[model samples]
Target: MAEISAVKEAWEIRQRFKPEIWFSAPGAKHYENRYYANHHHSFVNISVTGEACACRCDHCNGKLLQSMVGTPTPLEMRRVVDQLLDKDCRGILVSGGANSQGEVPLLAFMDSIAYASQKGLKVLVHSGIISRETALGLKAAGVDQVLLDVIGDQDTIHQVYHLNQRPEDYLRAMLFCREADLNIAPHVVIGLHYGQIRGEMKALEMIREAWPETIVLVILTPSCGTAMEGLQPPNLADVGEVIAKARLTNPNIPITLGCARPSGQYKRQVEILAVDCGVNGMAYPDEETVIYARSKGLQTMFTEECCSLIARNV
Candidate 1:
């Protein structure tokens, strides 16, 4: 099949770069005697708004928020973080649905984040289109890092996110993080244009220019009950091409495949190709990928935290 052939070709082309294997699921994943050593209760995600989002993009329709434990107020978030720390959680990802401006109103929760940090919890915030003032607040709060999605295509921003903002808005946000001297891991969602590859390379170029602490590459997963539900995933080879370009553009920066993508055979195939295409790490990779990496005589390791933390951990 063409898909199989494309994967093989990409694999052949990917041998030039050294590879690093990552196993970053909060829970342990075992394959035979080998296991990804994870702190099952070490890290967790919390949503500020339970099952609610103003953007409600075509691909998500607020479904992604359902998986995150929701806390609507600073007091609630503080209470939840205390409970999680009591249970031995190492870090927490503070996330929520964005408002109409594609911003997660995190200013209101800054005090809670600071409180968690003071109580010795590593804090990571998914800050969307933040202002310099807000970025400073997050920095003063002792937050570990921030995650911001960078979209290169203007049309994708409008059509998929239903936002009138331009790519410059994203670039400016990264600048805000930099001005605050905050650690940031900028994410670029591949194939966000209705399951078709678009602007990934441009986005990578922008990220490379920004010089982020780390870069996370994720693929768009069309969630159920959304307009993009029936759309097929982009070609694995095309995804590989984007990865290859990213490697070439930012050779020193750490790039990892984040824990968001299509599942089943498609996911397995993409993982194998991702290893070859020079991604430094992967979040929750398939067992066969571990075997393949070992067979290629590459050293591998695992972490219980999110792949975005590789920059800080590794």
Candidate 2:
């Protein structure tokens, strides 16, 4: 089913435009019987709260956080950093499960963040809904980038996030990052409600107003244990539409198809469409798109650093 769609979508992409994409999947992948693989940036989320997120959002079943490296203490964090440093890591996306107030307890570990920076690890954190005070702490700690998932609608927030947050709360969080002079990279999950496109465009507009340095477009992936397991992800056409809107809205800003989007040709088609839509760059670009972009006019490059906030210089 996906292969047939990819064939059709490829013709559409060639007719419209060719955009750059990066593939961030670990191990290996093949699309339409052609090998697609690349060495891209990798992140070790040294989680402080393990898999226990407070929000328990409708789209995520608490399975995603389990992939992060669990580190509950400063010493444990240091150990993880030490290993990543030895391996010459480009950066780490320090993240964890949120607490009841929609917060990730990363502020308390400023010293650990500082330690990682001192050892030459560029650190980016996925914070929960935050206050100015917390943002200040992250800045003082030398965090290279800070990422937050921002929902645009109150219904999505209430129904999906199961929290009492208004959409404005997400705006406040974006400004908090802005005021602290940190590189802000906000994520807007596409098809967050069983693969629906509700509130996605609003999320893009919020990003434009915030003027974030980078935006990550991670889509919803179903987990078997969650309430939404039986639900399907939003269609590639819908997600592609949102990505095109985001690119047109924020032309210069970098947009990434993060590692969390739906798999198979849904991944390839959305990624290929991302390049067509004028995304500045992608974190883990698909191999076919990379080859095609080079064939067109883009100067495709690879780096081991986190794809979200890669500086314009490189």
Clashing pairs in 2: 19-275, 19-276, 20-275, 21-285, 22-284, 22-285, 23-284, 23-285, 195-233, 195-234
Off by over 4 Å in 2: 1-42, 311-314
* Worst 10-residue lDDT window, candidate 2: 24-33
Off by over 4 Å in 1: 1-20, 27-34, 37-39
Residues 1-314 of candidate 1: C-alpha lDDT, one tens digit per residue: 22454445545544544554566775422223255556656788889887889998999999988878899999999899889988998888888999889989888988899999999987889987888988999999999999999999999999999998988899889898999999999999989999887777777777776789888989989899999997998887788878777766676677788888898999888887777666767888787888877786667887777788887544
Could you tell me every candidate's TM-score relative to the true structure? Answer: 0.91, 0.85
lDDT of each: 0.81, 0.72
Candidate 2 lDDT: 0.72
